[model samples]
Structure formats: structure tokens, C-alpha cells
Target: MDEKKAAILGEIPRLRRYARSLLRDRDSADDLVQDCLERALVRLDNWQTGESPRRWLFTIMHHLFIDQMRKVNRRGEAAMLPLEASEAQAAPAEQVESIASREIIDALQAMSPDRRAALVMVAIEGFSYAEAATILGVPAGTLMSRIARGRDELRGLLDDAARRRAIRIVEK
Candidate 1:
């Protein structure tokens, strides 16, 4: 039990980071991480030794994140904050170009939850296609389609967002 607890403790940061990226809100991410850890701890007796704890934790986080996304979607309200404000308190960037590129985060928030999760798994979390497919519980071909469509949707959404921003600036 102690060994299992130690193992879970070690993976908390990575799990939290993935959740934060998916949820896009600091408070909700932390809550999700805590819930995941508690669930894992309770189920630790069933966890097989020699298996990757990180992967197990990630699987739990993935399900929890998906469940939360569903609930949020049912509420018919957006969970994402404005992209610029979200980045303002992040780690300082040494280059102005880095700051300019931060608008992509906002664009990501505008995406559908399925696309956002798929894109984050591949593009942000650096998971391979197979790993992401398994994590997302989709067939490889379906995963590919989701990712391709996700990219196209993100591009369109971001372009629209940027255009709106530009128009607002011009109007001002």
C-alpha cells in the first residue's frame, strides 16, 4: 500500500499538467487531479505491479476529463477563458514572438471538446497515434479522422477568432 501510494505521488504532476491542458482552467484541473488520485488510491489494490503507473494514472485522468467535458457540454456554457488572460500569468517569455504565438491557446479553447482532447493528446502530450487511440478508446482509423478533422476545425475557428479580433481593433 505504501509503495502504491509513493508511486501515485510521483505521477501527480504529469497527470495534473495533462488535466490542466485538457480542462483549460486551473481550479477545475486541480479538482480533477485530486479526484483522480483519490480514485487511484482506493483502487490501488487492484493495480498490477510492474505495470506503468503513469499510464494507469493517465487513463484515469482521461476518463475523468471526458466525463467532466460531457457534463459541461450538457450545461451549454463554455468553460474556456480568453486566451490572452490565460497566458498573462504563465511563465515569463524571453521573446516577443513567443507571446504573439500564445494566441493559439485561445484558439484551442474555442474548439469542440473532442477535437481539443484529440489534438492535445497528439500535439501537446506527445502521445503516439496508437497510444492516443487507445487512450481515447477509438480505432486507429477513427483517431486519424478525428485528428484530421480536429486540425481543420481548429484552423477555421482560430481564423474566425483572429478576424474578429482584427475587426474589433479596426473599429476602435
Candidate 2:
């Protein structure tokens, strides 16, 4: 494949990962990724040479996600489905890891979409603050603030969950 096409194709995994985190449903996330790819293909000409394809694709995905959320809000529909146990389950040897992962996912779901996106980009995806800001179409300072607030909120959510779990264990 040509360089441009190859670059775009290489970004599929990252795009899907980000989409899955945003939507928390495999089918919905796949659909979102498909829509993002379709839009990117159509606007490929507008993409500048030497630019980071991953960042550009992320920018497209971010905009599409925002637009989709707006449409759902207008229709008064739930934007995300509840996390399914089957989807969060992992291998026996990694039971603890699986529980921790589930807790983090739950915390992320509780956060505002904007904050979650910023955290996912900077923390999970390892994007620089400036790159994440560009992808989200916000200033660097704004992105930093979002990440800080997101971390604080996520910590609180996890702490609450831990306390509830402790109570359940104690009551047993």
C-alpha cells in the first residue's frame, strides 16, 4: 500500500482503542471507528504532508464523537450503555488486574466525556499535552486542567468503590 494509506491503516488499533474507551461497547466503538475512517478517507486530501497521521485521525474521531454525543443528547437518548460483565472479565491468573481494570473503566464512565477524552489521550494513549489539546481543539492549558480534574475525579470514584467493597467484605 502507499505511504499515506499505510499510515492511516496503522492507526486503526489506536483509533479503536480510543473509541472503545469513549463508548464502552464493542459494537458501538467499531461503528464509531468505521465512521471515523470513512470521514478521514473522504478528507484525505486536506491532510497535510509530514503531519502525524495518528493525531490527525484522532482529531477526526474526537469531532465525530462530540457530534454523535450532541445528536444523542438532542434525542434524549442514553449516550453509553452499561458496562457488561462479560466484556470486562479477564483470565483467572490476572483476576486482580481485571478487577482493577474494571474499576478504572467504571470511574472513566462516571467522568464527563470531555474529561475522559483528555485523560485517555494524555494518560492512556501517551499523547503530549499539546498534541491532545490539538486533537481536542482546545488550548494546552485547558487540556492540562482537564487532565488534572479528571485524575482527581477518577481517584475519588475509585476510592468510593473501594470503600463500598470493603464494607461488603466486612458485612459478610
Candidate 3:
């Protein structure tokens, strides 16, 4: 049992990185990792020997991430993100990049959780559609459509933001 747990521990960093990219915040990623570890530990008896431990841990993490996404979608951004003011005050960066990242995050938050998950898995994580579909528990065609929609929506938001910036410059 100790050996099994030790082996599972080795995959935590990759899981954390994947969760961080999916969640886009440090604390949330940590929480996801903790949850994934707990779940994996509790379910260790079910894990078959010689199967990919990394993939198994990732599957658990991905499911937890999906659940977190659904909860946020239900509650909306304002309800989920109470640290925004503090974060904004502390952020030191070129104004344009900050504004763009904010717009992108906002656009991502507006997307359906399923679509957002698909985007993260396919685009950000560089997972193949088949692998993403397996993680998402959806058909590959469905995953592709969700990715397409997510990309289109993100592009629209970015384009609108650019246009607004251009308009402001013109007015000045």
C-alpha cells in the first residue's frame, strides 16, 4: 500500500500543471490536486496493476476540474471570484496585456462548462480529440464541435475588445 501511494505521488506535478492550466488559478489547482490525491488514495483498491498510473490520476483530476467548472458556471464569475479587486490591485503588467487576459478569461467564463472543458483539453493541453473525448466522456465529433464553438466565441470576444480599443484611440 505504501509503495502504491508512493508511486502515485510521483505523478502529482504533472497533474498539478494540467489542473493549473485548466483552472487558471493556483489555489484552485492545489485544491484539485488534493482532491485528486484523496480520491485516488481512497480508490486504490480498484486500480489495476500495470495500468498507467499517470493517466488514472489525470482522469480523476479532469473529472474534478469539470465538476468545479460546472459549479462556477452555475454561480457565475462574480459569485466565484471574490479576490478580483485584490488581484487587480497587485497585478503589475503592461495595461494592454492585462486587459486582453481579462477579456479572454471573461470570455472563457461565459462559455458553457462543457465547451470550456473541451477547449482546455484540446487546445491548451494539446490532447488529441480522441483523448480529449475520452476525458470529457463525449464523442470525438462532439468534442470537436465544442472546441470549434469555444474558439469562435473567444475570437469574437478578443476581436470586440480590439475594436473597442481602436474606437477609444480614434476618439482620443
TM-score: which is higher, 1 or 3?
A: 1
Model 2 spans with C-alpha error above 4 angstroms: 79-97
Question: Per-prediction TM-score, please?
Answer: 0.78, 0.86, 0.71
lDDT of 2 by residue, 85-156 (tens): 334544345334466777777778778889999999998899999899999999998999999999999999
**Model 3: per-residue Cα lDDT over 62-169, one tens digit each:** 788777766766788545554333244443344334666765765665566678778977676677898878877888899999999889987886787678779989
In model 1, the worst 10-residue window by lDDT is 91-100
Please list the residue runs of candidate 3 whose C-alpha ends up more than 4 Å from where it truly belongs after superposition.
1-7, 72-103, 167-172
Query: What are the root-mean-square deviations of the candidates from the true structure over C-alphas?
Result: 4.2, 3.7, 4.3
Residue pairs with clashing backbones, model 2 = none
lDDT (Cα, tens digit) per residue for candidate 1, span 44-113: 8778888778777877878888888787767855544444553444633452434235556566766777
Candidate whose lDDT is highest:
2
Going through the candidates in the order shown, the clash numbers are 0, 0, 0
Deviation in angstroms for 60 in model 3?
Answer: 1.0
Predictions ranked by lDDT, top down?
2, 1, 3
Q: Over the full model, what C-alpha lDDT does candidate 3 score relative to the true structure?
A: 0.74
